[model samples]
Target: MTTLLIRDGVIDDADQIAGVHVRSWQAAYRGLIDQEVLDGLSIPDRAEGWRRNLSDPLPTIIGILVAERDGEIVGWTSFGSGREEEGAGDGEVYGIYADPAEWSTGVGRALLDAAEQRILDAGHTRAYLWVLDGNERADAFYARQGWVADGASKVEERPGMSLREHRRVKHLAGS
Candidate 1:
C-alpha cells in the first residue's frame, strides 16, 4: 500500500477533484437515487461547479485535502463551517469522496482527521454532516468515527430532485 498524504488542494486539482466527485457519486449513489438523476450526472458540470465553489466566498469556509499516492492525486475531502441555518456551533463536512481503489486504506480517515483538526483550530468543538438515508457504508464509517445520528432528517437537493438524508454529528473535546 502506498502512503497517502493529505494536503490543501491547489487550483491544478480542479479536474482531479471533479473526477473523484463524479466517480464516487456514481458508485455510491447508484440504485439509491433516481435513475434520471444518475443519468444526468455530468463531469464537466461538476468540474465547473467545483471550480466556482473554490473560487467563490460564502458563509462556510471551504478547504480541500488531496490524498496523493506515487505523486498522483487519488482522492480528496472538502469541508467547512456549517451553514448559518444549521444552528450548529461546529464545522461541517460537505463533500468526501475517495477513489474506490483506496477504500479502507485510511485515506478517508486521514482526510476526516485533517478536517476535524481544521474545525478545532477554528475554535469549534463539534462537527456535523449529512449522509444519505440509504448510504449504509458512509453512515457506518461515520459511526465508527464516533459520530451519532441526531434524529434529524431533511431533503437534500440533487439533480432535478431531492433525496432524504440524516444529520450526523461528532463532539470534540479540547486538544
Candidate 2:
C-alpha cells in the first residue's frame, strides 16, 4: 500500500470527489438508507454541485481535505463554523466520506483527524456532525473518535421520503 496523503482540496478535485461521494454513499448506506434514493444519484449532477461548492465556497469553510493514495482520492471531509443553530463555541464537521473499498484502511480516520484539527484551529472548542439514524458503522466510528450524540435529531427530506439523523459532538478543548 502506498502512503496516504491528506491535503487541502482544490476545484480540480471536484470531479473525483463527486465520484467518491456517490460510491461511498451507495456502499456505506446500502442497508441503512433507502435503495431508491441511492440509485437516483447522478455523478454528473453531484459533480456540478461540488464544482459550485468549491468555486464559490462559503466564507465559513475552514477547509476541505482530500485523502489520496496512489494518486487517487479515497476519502474527503469538510469542516467549519456550525451551520446549525448552536452555542457560540461549536465548530462543525459538515461531512466525511470514503470510498467503501478503502474502508478500515485508515483513510477515513485521516480525513477525520484533519478535520478535527482544522476545526480546532478555527477557534472553536467543540465540534459536531450529523449521521443518518441507524448507521451503526458511522456512529461506531465516531464513538471511537470520542464523539457522542447530543440528543439532537432532525428529519431531512429526500426525493421520496424523510430520513432521520442525529447530531454527534466532541469537545476539542482537552483533546
Candidate 3:
C-alpha cells in the first residue's frame, strides 16, 4: 500500500466523507442494522449534513480527520468532548468509518491512531466510542487497539427500529 496520509478534513472533503460513511455503514452494519435502513442511506443528504457540520461544528467538536491513499479519501473520523453524562471528562470519538473496499488495509487503524493522539493532545486521559452491539469485526478491531467494552450500552432509536450500541473505552498511555 502507498503511504496513507491523515489530514484535517476540509469542507471540500464532505462529499467523499459522506460516500465513505454511507458505504461503510451499508457494509459494516449489514444484518446488525435493518437492511432497509442501510439501503435507504442517502449520500447527498449525508453530504449536506457533513457540509454543515464541517463548516460550523458544534461547540463540542474538536476536529475531523480524513485518511487519504494516493489522493483519494478512504476513511474519516470525528472526535471531541464526550457527550454522555457519565463521560464528562473524557474525549469521545463521535464516528469513524473506512470505505468498505479499504477495510483491513490499515485505513481504520491509522485514522484511530490519529484520533487518539489528538484526544491526548487535548489533555484527555480517557476516550470512548460506541459500536453497534453485534459488530464483531469492529469489536475485535477496537480490542486490538486497547479499547474495551466498559459494560455501558444504549439503545438508539432510528427511523423505524432501535439499535443497540455498547461503549468502548481506552485510557491514553501517558495519562
CA deviation > 4 Å runs, candidate 1: 84-86
lDDT of 1 by residue, 33-123 (tens): 8767877788788788778776773557757788888877778887888873764677888878888777888888888888888887887
Better of 1 and 3 by TM-score: 3
Best by lDDT: 3
lDDT of each: 0.81, 0.90, 0.94
**What TM-score do all the candidates reach, one by one?**
0.92, 0.95, 0.97
Ranking by lDDT: 3, 2, 1
Per-residue alpha-carbon lDDT of candidate 3 for residues 39-62, written as tens digits (9 for 90 to 100): 999999999999999999988888
lDDT of 3 at 152: 94
Worst 10 residues of 2 by lDDT: 81-90
Give the true-structure RMSD of model 3.
1.0
Separate clash counts for every candidate:
0, 0, 0
For candidate 1, what's the RMSD? 1.7
lDDT tens readout by residue for model 2, 144-169: 99999989999989778787899999
Best by TM-score: 3
